[model samples]
Target: MSRRRRKALPSEPVRCVIETLSHDGRGIARDNGKAQFVDGALPGETVMAKFTSTRSKFDELRAVEVLEADDARMTPPCDFADLCGGCSLQHMSGESQIRFKEDTLREHFAHFGGIEPDEWVAPMRSPALGYRRKARLGVKYVPARESVLVGFREKRNSFLTDIDRCVVLDPRIGDRITPLRELLHGMDAYRRIPQVEVACGDDSAAMIFRNMDPLSDSDRQSLIDFGQAHDLHIYLQPKGPDTVHRIWPETGEERLSYDMEEFDLTMKFHPMDFTQVNVDINRNMVHRAVEWLDIQPGERVLDLFCGLGNFTLPLARSAGQVVGVEGDDAMVVRGRENAELNGLSNVAFHGADLQADFTAQPWAAEGFDKILIDPPRSGAQEVCEYLTAFGAKRIVYVSCNPATLARDAGVMVRNGYRLVRAGVMDMFPHTTHVESMAMFERVDN
Candidate 1:
């Protein structure tokens, strides 16, 4: 079969006025009845954009120069903001970014769910910069430059962006990008290392280097030295996720922890475990989820898609009993460990395929009085189908994707629940990713 050739982009930059912003933070403009997605441009701004890609329905462009800027436009904090894919809305003010996210969520609810919340809660906010506690940084050795690049990929490209520091990441690892590049460049197996996973706790930080090949003894020692000097834990992944092991501070426990002061709980997790990237937002989110659920004393609660008992442990503190269900058995084990560590005997952890019919499970026999769900980007349509069967009076849903959440919310509404309130949370700021929460109450039909 003959392959179709891609249409060549125009050589000259075209001038246009941005009419609106897309969900992914791109500016939408129309030229000759065709839509164009303009990167690095804001709504209501006029720009000269160079065409990067041409498609059948629309074209993709990168704004070369802003002829007129929006009031919300400001200087980006990161030097590589225009090139790095780490953050997309750095040019927009923090308030405007929140508004955009809220508006996106509102649109999703109205379009996908065919419903809206009775009241829109105030958007949950946090520090705009230096809040990222986790990231996977790309590592590449450039022979042409005689240096190693350690940062995010370039916008719309797989190539690593040439950056020295990150403004939004936790300073522990973000500020050390240049030093990390230097250290990797000195290593004998510099080219063998592909990426570094960064995980930061309240008191400590860790870096897991994914080595494609065996590291030399000198290279390993240098990594340890760097960790010791910077007070960062060093881990190495030789093959797979199970192969990740700590190398530095060989004496202490191989775990990092964060404290939920309101609940008086300290959650311990492995460096490779799934965790929220923004700690402040997570803490606030947990608090709001618990408060919104309104778990009365002696009432049973259920937490679905629970990881490491982040909400289950806290919910147990208030409810008579709390059950946490997760798909990953490893996370179930971690949840049990967290429950034990917190001395909460009222909670239990169960592992099950949440996408399937879990109503027949042993834990599901006893109906829950309240429920809390923190699903991933795909959302929980399967579980939402049988949500009201549990007879929960109130439910709180924490979502990372608005479209999926809206779709699932419609399912819940059809199952005899009313959308009470909903709002966006700035879990990931300066990025198009929207984290939101919605409350639902069972109607007494």
Candidate 2:
């Protein structure tokens, strides 16, 4: 087949009046009856934007200058906010951002699920800056700049942003981006280093370098010296995540951990393991979920997609017994280990693909009084159908994607569960990413 030619982007800037914000925080504007999604433009604003990509349905634009600003707009704190794609809502006030997210959640539930919660819980809040504990930074060696760039990609583009620091990331790593770039530039395998994975705990930070080629002895020594100087953990991944191993502090195990003092629980995990990027919001989310669950001392609880027992251990502290189920056997093993580390005998961990027909699983046969679900962006559609089998009185769902959560809530409602209460959580501050929790109760129970 012959190749089709893509249309060229507009050479001159196009004027637009942003009507509203899209789900990804882009401005929704119309030009000549066609919609244009513009980055860096807020609603109630008039902007001059240049088209980045042209498509049949709409064009992608990046606002170059604002003619009029939204009342909720604020100056972005980050120096590279205009270029970096790490955050999209830095220009919106924190309070307004939360309000936007809350409204977005309601819209998702009403549009996708055809229902709304009986009670709207207050939106959870957290600090807006230097709160991220986990991130994946893109690395690029530009010959024109004669330097290595280590940061997020440019807005709606594949090129790295070439940032000196990131305001949203933890200061330990974000503040050292320049030094890290210099260190990488001095290495022989700098060109082969495609990205850096950052994971931080309460006290220490870990960085995993995804190196495409072998590192020289000098590169290894330099990395060790830098780690020692900064008191950080450095890991090298020659290929995949499984290949990640510590290059610095080569003598002992340096597992990363975070403590949930509210429950007297410590969760130890590998640097590559999935954990909340915003630690404070995670704590609030856990506590609120526990409160909504209202677990009785004699009740049995089930936790799905339970990683590192973040919620299972806490739930165990209140419930009579808790069983945590996860798809990854590795996470389940770690969850079990975390349970033991916390000296919790009432909690159990099991491994199963939650997306499958899990109603027949051994844990499913057990009668539980409460259930907790923390699923990924895809949500728990396949498993929502089976939750009725557990006959739990209450189910608290912690969702990172509001759309999927609403979709699954529809399934639960059809299965005779009522959406009792729901609210948005600021797990990811200054970004369009929505983290929310919803409470559901079986009507016939």
Candidate 3:
């Protein structure tokens, strides 16, 4: 038997009117009762789309020309927005982007959780451009072009986009992409380098190069010179993550820090550690979470999925004691280190598998007055099952994914809590990724 060959895409462009937006920022249209997802198109727009792939249930296409534009549509700021996969909703205005995210969250709650909050808070907004502080850029050397490409992958493809600069990235690193390409092209290990991870803090930025082979002295010196000239800390990973070591500034601490002026605190972390990509939005998020929790001086607060004391230390300033729990022990250690650096002895860090039963643990013996949860994209379904055991009066949940948040919100409602207020956060301005927050209060409390 032979495998069936895939159907060929239509050679001519098809005209369609976009009815709505998909969760991933694609425009949805119907053609002969079948759905079509068109990239770079907005809802309420008429476009001529070229089919890229065909499927039985639905088809995929890219919008070649917009015949009619939506009121929310705007010209993308990035020159390579159409080619780069890093951002998806750049054509939509920032205000419209926030509205789309809010709508997405509302639909998730209504469909998955079968519920809605009593009140919806205002969406937290951030700078529409130059807000991204963390990114992993692809590096490839093309001999035909006699140059190297350093940027994100092309939309819907594995090939790197031929971009000179990224407007969304922090200008410190985004502005240097062309120079970076030139510098890498001159290196003997240009072909051996696969990617570069960039991270920026308030005062400094760092880049870690993933090198397949050991660099020669000349290549190493070249990297050092680039770092020194650009004021970037450089690290090279020859084999594995554990082998990453800093080469430039060869002396002091191997860390970058961002200041939380609201709490009069500074958060220090390694370049590889997990940190929020948008610093302004993160600061606003932290402030809002703390304010919503309404921590009192005599109360004890519990922070779940805490990483590096982002919320724990801030709560400690108001609460009598704050206990933070995380799955990664390294992050637990980092939390403790941050606590010590802040000179706060009221906060304690613990490492535990949050998905498992930890009710017997000593920390769980005493009930908490308030709770703050900042779970990952997977959400905290298992942890939601045990929230009643802690008997916290108020629970604040910060979520990166709205679907999981809705699912967990239903669990909280079923467990004798009511969804009081929920809202969205514009963390990634040009992406469909929805960052949200909700306030839950015990029915009897």
The per-prediction tally of clashing pairs is 0, 0, 0
Total backbone collisions, model 1: 0
TM-score per prediction, in order, is 0.98, 0.97, 0.98
> Which scores higher on TM-score, 1 or 2?
1
Candidate 3 residue 421 Cα shift, in angstroms, is: 0.3
The digit string of per-residue lDDT tens for model 3 on 140-242 reads: 9998998899999988999999998899999999999999999999999999898999999899999999999989999999999999999999999988778
Task: Write down the TM-score for model 2.
Answer: 0.97
Q: What lDDT tens digits, residue by residue, belong to model 1 across residues 216-308?
A: 999999999999989999999999899999999898888899999999999999988999999999999999999998888999999999999
What TM-score does candidate 1 reach? 0.98
Q: Taking the tens digit of each residue's C-alpha lDDT, what string does model 2 give over 1-445?
A: 9898876777999899999999999999997889999998988999999988888889899999999988898999998888888888888899889988998999999897479999998999988899999999999999999999999988777999978988889999999999999999999998999999999999789989898988999999989999999989999999877799998878776689999999999999989999999999999999999999999888999999998899999999999899999999989999999999999999889998787887777776777899999998999998899888878899999999999999999999999899999999998888899999999999986
What do the candidate models score in CA lDDT, each in turn?
Answer: 0.94, 0.91, 0.94
Residue range with the least summed lDDT across 10 consecutive positions in model 2: 358-367
- Cα error, candidate 2, residue 274 (Å): 0.6
Candidate 3's C-alpha runs over 4 A off are 1-3
